[model samples]
Target: MSTTRHELLTAFDLLLAPERFKDYGPNGLQVEGRTTIRKIVSGVTASRALIEAAIHADADAIFVHHGLFWRGQDGRVTGWMRQRLGLLLGDDVNLFAYHLPLDAHPELGNNAQLGLQLGLVAHAGSAGRFGEQEIGFLGAPEDGATFTSGKKLAAHVERVLKRPVTLIEGQRPIKNVAWCTGGAQGYFEAAIAAGADAFITGEISEPQAHYARETGVSFLACGHHATERYGAPAVAAHVAAQLGLAHEFIDIDNPA
Candidate 1:
């Protein structure tokens, strides 16, 4: 069955509540395509490959976490940008993207889903602030379960995410932990303030190493793409199921 673009967007907007966020990009319908959609494709980023893959898959709509437009980018439709836009426009494929909104959702957000993957029970709201938006999550192991040490936590992350985790070890025997899914190493200070024994994020900065050493909060960099693989797919599946459309999640892997 096909659903109108308006029906899909309204359902998603209500579900995600993007109005609550001050996002870097638009939360819905970045590009208009067909008015009705039967097949949808979802991915982490709206890269050229993913767009082309959507085209090949005969997807009427493409939903993603990282959209083409951003806060600081020039508003010109030229160069690589021109090509990407051309594909979407030429194919009449809808492009829907949600950046901070996708990251901030309590259940379907990247951080929350990652927490579930790692067996963490959400204990409190994220201490990390992005303007007024809380983009991270704070958690601990579920009752009667534990991750013995920082090394063990890192190993679990590596096993779950299927990527090599870079560990900056702190004090041993991790108990409380905090995490944000993508390129959020800067939130380590917030994690520390929240009394997290360990912090996990997608990317780490140079200064974060020293912060981890001095503050006794272990840091783990688990690759941005790897960390964010869950949210978009979850959102897509929900949207498709809600709108009675077929949804396929496409993984165009990126090492970064």
Candidate 2:
């Protein structure tokens, strides 16, 4: 079964509501390909490897969290950019990407998925949003649960993500946690101000160590790619199921 590219994009727009976000890049379709899309390949990024893999899979469309164009990127499509674009253009495969929209969606977003993986729940009474455009989320363990210590929380996160986590231990137990996936260290201070016992994000900057020490709030830096790998595939799968199209999620590993 196949669906028109317009129908797929419309479904995504209705699901994500891209207009609600001021994202770093364009949200919906980036590169135009065949009007009829049968199979879609979803991944974390639109790197050369992912593009090649999609082409090999004979995908009619490529859906990703990270796409080729960004707000301040160079206009010239040369070097690596040229190669990636050439692959999609040559094969006439559609490229669809969603940035902040993918992160902020309450159900199928990166933050929500990461929280689910870690067994965190967004309570109704708490003010769940923080940071620019309220992209970050504040949540707690399910059913009034709390980690006995930061180390225990870190261990759980590491086990769930299947990767080593860089933890800045706090002076107190972790009860309420805040998180924003994918290079969201900048939101740490906001998380702290929002009264989070701990903050989790994809990357940590140099200053966050000191903040964690002084503020008594734990900090965890999971891998940027690791934290963001779920949203694109989840969104794609929903679209596929709705449109009766085939979908495959391809993970191109990146340790950073």
Question: Which model scores highest in lDDT?
Answer: 2
- The superposed Cα distance between candidate 1 and the true structure at residue 47, in angstroms, equals 0.4
Evaluated at residue 5, the lDDT of candidate 1 is 90
Q: What's the CA error at residue 150 for candidate 1, in Å? A: 1.4
Q: Estimate each model's TM-score.
A: 0.95, 0.98
- Each model's total of backbone clashes: 0, 0
Among all candidates shown, the one with the greatest TM-score: 2
Every candidate's CA RMSD: 1.8, 1.0
**Mind giving the per-residue lDDT tens digits that candidate 2 earns over 12-79?**
99999999988888989999999999999999999999999999999999999998899988899899
After superposition, the stretches of candidate 2 with alpha carbons farther than 4 Å from their true spots are none
